[model samples]
Target: MSEIRKIIEDLRKNKAGMRGILAIIIIFAYGILGSYFIMGLNINNSIYYTVITVATVGYGDIIPVTPLQKLFSTSLALTGLGLLAYIFTIIINSFEENLHDIRSGRHMEKRLAEMENHYILCGFGRVGTAVYEELMKRNQKVIIIEKNDEKLEDIEEDDNVIALHANATEDKTLKKLNIDKSLGVIVTTGSDVDNLFIVLTTRELYEDAWIISRASKKESIKRLKNAGANKVISPEVSGGNDIYFAAVQPNLVHITQNHGIDFLEREFEILKKHNCHLENIEYHFPGIRTPVTRTIGVLDEEEKDHFIDMVKNNPEVKESLDVMYNSVNGVHSHWISGPDKTHVDMAIEELKKEGNLLGINLDFKEINEFTKQFKE
Candidate 1:
């Protein structure tokens, strides 16, 4: 029973490819051999007759004359008809299954395309699954790209979570997933080689995307990092460290288990605060061409010169404190403080009056609201 179940499962996953091959072989062998011996016909004539007979397209040009020949013809007709029925059943089932897969794949593709500022997880193993769970717990949108379809079969269905059965190393797959628009990618396949390939491919597709890769071997860590992975982790190393910590520092392990699990959750709040600061500025100053304003990090070099200078000189304008600069692409984005919204506004207005030197544009988050709007 177990063996039968295993075979059925394999067939279900493989789309009857092996069964189709075996059927073709049986049909050709039986057709040629049966017709040649029973009809006493030449190879070419026997094959032609077999084709017509099996397809139920019998032409009157070939007819069985002897008793034995007629008996064989009747037997062959029964066998052919039975085979045809079986073939039709398989074909129809295959057609329906293919149609289902087409629809499912298209839905996955559309979901992946619609994802923006999301993370692409390129594996479904233990480490990858852990990361996925943590991200989901934080309400982060995640699209999983795993080559193994069986691994994806039981995934929990959610709008923010999608599983794509595709090779991450393929450029077409990454492009179809809109890797360039993603915030980052995580490669956690068990193989260091596969992770390295995925990192390289993802980096090629999206230079700005943050990529984290898993390395199995100690020596492969540097290689993975050099291959464009922003962070490279060896599961073996982490696992060993975890075991050591659990043995020697049980209290620390408990603290980590209790607290570190929610680290990503806190990141969600931090991201929300940052976005609220930017949106507050945009909302308050509508006539300032708010769409043409940009945000920069507090630690940016440009901020040290322009933003810091203005914020330092004018203590009255303290509502917004982020600098607005135009990038080569005519758009730039950064973070600001909520209290400094007015300062940034006045600075932008002053710059505009001085003659539009910075050709900028607009940009603009919640927890449940944030997840619904931004998550995947």
Candidate 2:
């Protein structure tokens, strides 16, 4: 309803166009009046005759019997035909104008210029589509740049998504999207070369721009990073790793795939809190949790200092501290008693802020609960 109102408003924007439409309406009314009063026909028959004559149907059922009637009818038919031709011309011109707007991107230019702090997503292929949906779900501000006209048609007309039919590799297109004011950019084109170029162009345009790009080949990863991408992900490699893990560590796969990272974080924190008493110099973090065996990835110089002080005071606390440092490092944290789910989540988020630490993630709720014992 709102869109219809908007379209009507736009149609009326041209005063000449509205006047022409009004003229057509008045002419139709005149024809009906002349057919009824002047031609001495009944009102119903008068409307019917006028409509048919203007349409040029000429059924020949009703004849203008008198000489004056015939002359009046002939004039009405000719005038109606001329007006009909004019109306057709107006419709054609309006259609051409709209088509030109779509082709030239004039419709999007102003809207794009007004957007800021939005995300720019390049390409609309499979990967790009997934990213777009996820961003939409998160309620992020996103604008899509897709070159393929066929793919753009897939987007529903009523959807709130902003899609541009333009190549993203061009600097002019990026500028039009207000990339300089955007928070981040995602490049999901299948071609590594294209993704790299987009990253480079985006980086050049916005120095502080956060860019994440997809690369198909291993070598393309480093090149994309060098081109100024914050993160370069290879879907093939990640998919292969998932497959390998699913086969070798089926239980682990089920835990991660179904329960989510929160479940793991909560569970890990629980185990660590219970086992805090058994922290020895030869202590292991994941060994007691399950049958699986893997070396811990975290390295903490800060925790090492705190652990030495603990060993002299209470050797058990030092041992427990060692397991935490071995699991997650490079964070200022402190231990808290009787942790709940909320605290466990907050601690996990806090740990994540330290960024990637050796990529060896564990499922221990107690780990996070007791993980962050920091000096005030």
Top TM-score hit: 1
lDDT of 2 by residue, 1-376 (tens): 6644544565588675687789778877888888887789889998898899888888998899888889879988998898888767766676677678777676577677777656678988887776666555333467889899888887753233578889999988888888776656888888998999999999998898778787889889999999998777777766322221221121121111112122323434443433211111112233244322333212233554454455557768656654554453322122221112243344344434444221223345433332333211
In model 2, where do residues sit more than 4 Å from their true spots?
1-107, 157-160, 239-376
Model 1 per-residue lDDT tens digits across residues 1-376: 6644654554556655466557657876777787788788899998898788777788979999999888877766777787778766765676676678779888877777788756778888887777776555335567888999998988886877888888887888888877676656778888888888888887877787777777889999999889897777677767422221121111111000011111323422443443322221121221223334333222323533454456556654322332221111112222222212333344334334544222233222111222222222
Candidate 1, overall lDDT? 0.58
Error of 1 at 164 (Å): 1.7
Error of model 2, residue 80, in angstroms: 20
lDDT of 1 at 361: 36
Worst 10 residues of 2 by lDDT: 250-259
- Per-candidate count of clashing residue pairs (backbone under 3 Å): 13, 22
Q: Which candidate achieves the best lDDT against the true structure? A: 2
TM-score of each: 0.54, 0.43
Write down the lDDT of every candidate, Cα atoms only. 0.58, 0.60
